[model samples]
Target: MIDWARVGELVDEIGAEDFEEVVELFLLEVDGAISALEAAAGNAVIVEEQMHFLKGAALNLGFEALAQLCLKGEKAAASGRADVVGLDEVRQIYRSSRLQFERDLPDRLAA
Candidate 1:
């Protein structure tokens, strides 16, 4: 879920303080997106848009698993199939990924 190398590179590119800011912003945005996605359950149109945005954000932050899950959700939504992607599982994964990033980012930035 967490890509340490990418995190390191991000920190190097953005500087530690800016990296933290970006992480915080990402968390805030993604949390909202997750909520929107949950509320959009069974709504293929909304789900597709939400999942697409979330997936792109996740990829930028190196949340590979979350991004892949979102990709699945996006495709399923595009196909008009609700059963293919589990929103609950996606939510859980997002929460786990958020927690892991919050816990690990400091040390990673310090490094």
Candidate 2:
């Protein structure tokens, strides 16, 4: 599960204005990379690149589970093992994490 406490602390440290900006940046990067990864299919280079970017972004956001998924994707892609089906699992996790983040953020701020 996502760590709401850490997220709350991060929001408190950054302030609402800065937090919004960072979230926007994160969304842009994640959206773009996910799209590219989907389009690339079996292309190892593209998959690895997208996963690498996602790994870094997730790490920076303190999203440990998402970051770990990205790390696995990166290793798989690096090995030239194109498991397109497995990518869907990663996508699902990403979507779930993102949705949870969005849903919890406002409540955290309100509190």
Candidate 3:
């Protein structure tokens, strides 16, 4: 669900200070994207767009669970199965992963 190795690599690539800043941006941006996704519920086109954007962002940040959920939702939206997409699960997974990243990122960066 979470890709700690990728996260570590990102921290290393960007340096700790920049990595922290990037993480903050990711959290804030994804929070807004998730809210947009929730609000787009029942609208397949909007849902697909929201999920597609979120998927890319989540992948970059190693939010694997959220990315996977977004991928699923995006595919479903494309197939006109948007109603079957689990928005709640997406939200839950995102929240859990976000919390995990927030809690562990500093330590990981320090390491």
Evaluated at residue 107, the lDDT of candidate 2 is 81
Clash pairs, candidate 2, are none
Candidate 2, residues 1-111, lDDT tens digits: the string is 466676677778998789889888998988888888889877988888888999888876667688888888888888986563367777787889888888877887898
RMSD of 1: 1.4
Among residues 3 or more apart in sequence or in different chains, the pairs in candidate 3 whose N, CA or C atoms overlap within 3 Å are none
Model 2 weakest lDDT span, ten residues long:
81-90
Q: Model 2, stretches more than 4 Å misplaced? A: none
> Among all windows of ten consecutive residues in candidate 1, which has the lowest summed lDDT?
102-111
Candidate 1 lDDT at 62 equals: 88
In the range 1-111, model 1's lDDT, one tens digit per residue, is 987787777778998889878988998999898788778758889889988999998988889899999999899889997557787888889889888988887776666
> Which parts of model 1 have CA positions greater than 4 angstroms off?
none
TM-score of each: 0.89, 0.83, 0.89
> Where does the lowest 10-residue lDDT sum fall in candidate 3?
102-111
